[model samples]
Target: MKTLYTLGLALVLTPLPGLVQAQASAEPEIASYSIDTTLKISTDRKTRGVSDTHGEPGLELTVEAAHESGLIAQLQLGSVSRVNYPEGNNLNAMLALGWRGGNPEGWHYGLGAAREWFPGARVDEAPAGFDASFTPTGWVNTRFHTSYLVAELGWSYLTARYLYVVSRDFRGANTATVCGNYLLVKLPSGDLGPALDCYGSAMQHSRGTQLLDLDLSYPLNGQTKLVAHLGWQRVRNFRGLDTMDYRLGLEHQRWGLVWGAELAGASVRNRDLFIAIDTDGTMRQMEKPKLILTVAKKF
Candidate 1:
């Protein structure tokens, strides 16, 4: 249930050394603070190799403010798929507060706290026909959300990040739905089998889920760069829900716009854990492999 959003890669990375830096000895006035806003459109909105838009296009707007002392605050808003948020969700929103420092040529670090909100979204039942014999008694009856703390460390073109979930559950993932789905397939004969007690507690929470990732951006030329990322997600108390995700891509920047294309996919351990059902009765796998294309403008 990792719901991290796709961040614009080209716009966020530091350009090739000396290619975009001002002369070291030149005395240029420095602003104490600045604000940046970016609007992006993409073929799909991916979070850790999973499509949040259910293989559809996505639109996003992000605003960030930073001070000379390294304090930063950011807000992100983006389109989401109804398949993944059936109850109702116009957009996904995230707010983060953090600090980043150190020379671009040397070591750098960032620490922050972020929370993702899916307004009006809820998962109260299994998809129709998914498990008619199963009761939805144990489902969490509230809006979905994810809260986590992030820490990052980087040197030049390489960075590493770790996210630790602090909420009662990671997104909407819980043992109740997982176990219920398990019984659906395991007991196709319609027999209760080993009884409810054999399935363990149905009320377990996924509070300590974690994500660790490494990102690389190497300049292929002044206007183009090679980008890659690898990430692993571990769901605490749910070993079967773990996954590994990957991305490899190229990005180019010109004419005040950034363009990118990436091959992204994931190795999902449990297919039922991340399935989505559309309004048309379509069942979708959110972790499929696909090429993602994007264009973004920043001001």
Candidate 2:
């Protein structure tokens, strides 16, 4: 009986090392977490040419985590020198779930849902008895929120994405659907090793907004690159409101640190109407020919 018991114990111990190795090998290897910070200095802080900071600099810090299962969560904190609110800062957080597979040389698709929260971010309200023919008094403080369901499909140097807004603030100006497509072409080495990126987007809401853009990047050296961008935008609802914008910039990356400087400007038709009204019924024109500097670190 003693000899039989010893044989059973030996049988169990012999496979334990192999079992541990198999378990370890089965763990997913792609899970990661990262934190990054960016300091942005611009003459005007805005989204798509709508002024948010009223020509003030902005700083942002972001922390993100991702799992091998394609779940991601991120928190972004931003501060501006000026905002409609007295606090001069805001918080944005997002949680997303997505799956990405396949190599760049093959067709790939990613579908995800992201819930974005802008805690305490103010919404711009139309003036009392505002008319659609005329612009609102200006953007004022109100509660604004949004969510998105997004999908991307890509193969090689071309990609396309569709973004649908599931929720938004009471303001009717927000876009409900956005579709974007981009193509990248790498120029031959003799052509200064420049790369060209062409993009187009259509945003749908009460009306359609379309944008076409071209970006070029040329390597200046091992660590520095020169970039230029030009874009044209049109709004279907607002006639004579088409605009052209451009940017010239240079970026350098070294030791996981990135820095950039850009000069950007936009020419807008009926620019005054594009300005947002403040809670105090103030309308400030968008600043043009702005200089921006940015520094970022990744970990």
Which is the leading candidate under TM-score? 1
Off by over 4 Å in 1: 1-31, 125-139, 179-199
Task: Assess every candidate by TM-score.
Answer: 0.79, 0.55
**Consecutive 10-residue window with the lowest summed lDDT within model 1:** 1-10
* TM-score for candidate 1: 0.79
- Over 4 Å off in model 2, which ranges? 1-44, 80-97, 104-108, 123-141, 154-161, 170-222, 226-248, 265-269, 276-283, 287-289
Best by lDDT: 1
In model 1, what is the error at residue 179, expressed in angstroms?
4.3
Cα deviation in Å at residue 39, candidate 2?
Answer: 5.9
Global lDDT scores for all candidate models: 0.78, 0.49
Ten residues in a row with the worst lDDT in model 2? 176-185
62-84 in candidate 2: lDDT tens per residue? 66655444554556555533343
Q: lDDT per residue, candidate 1, 51-78, as tens digits? A: 8888899999999988778898999999
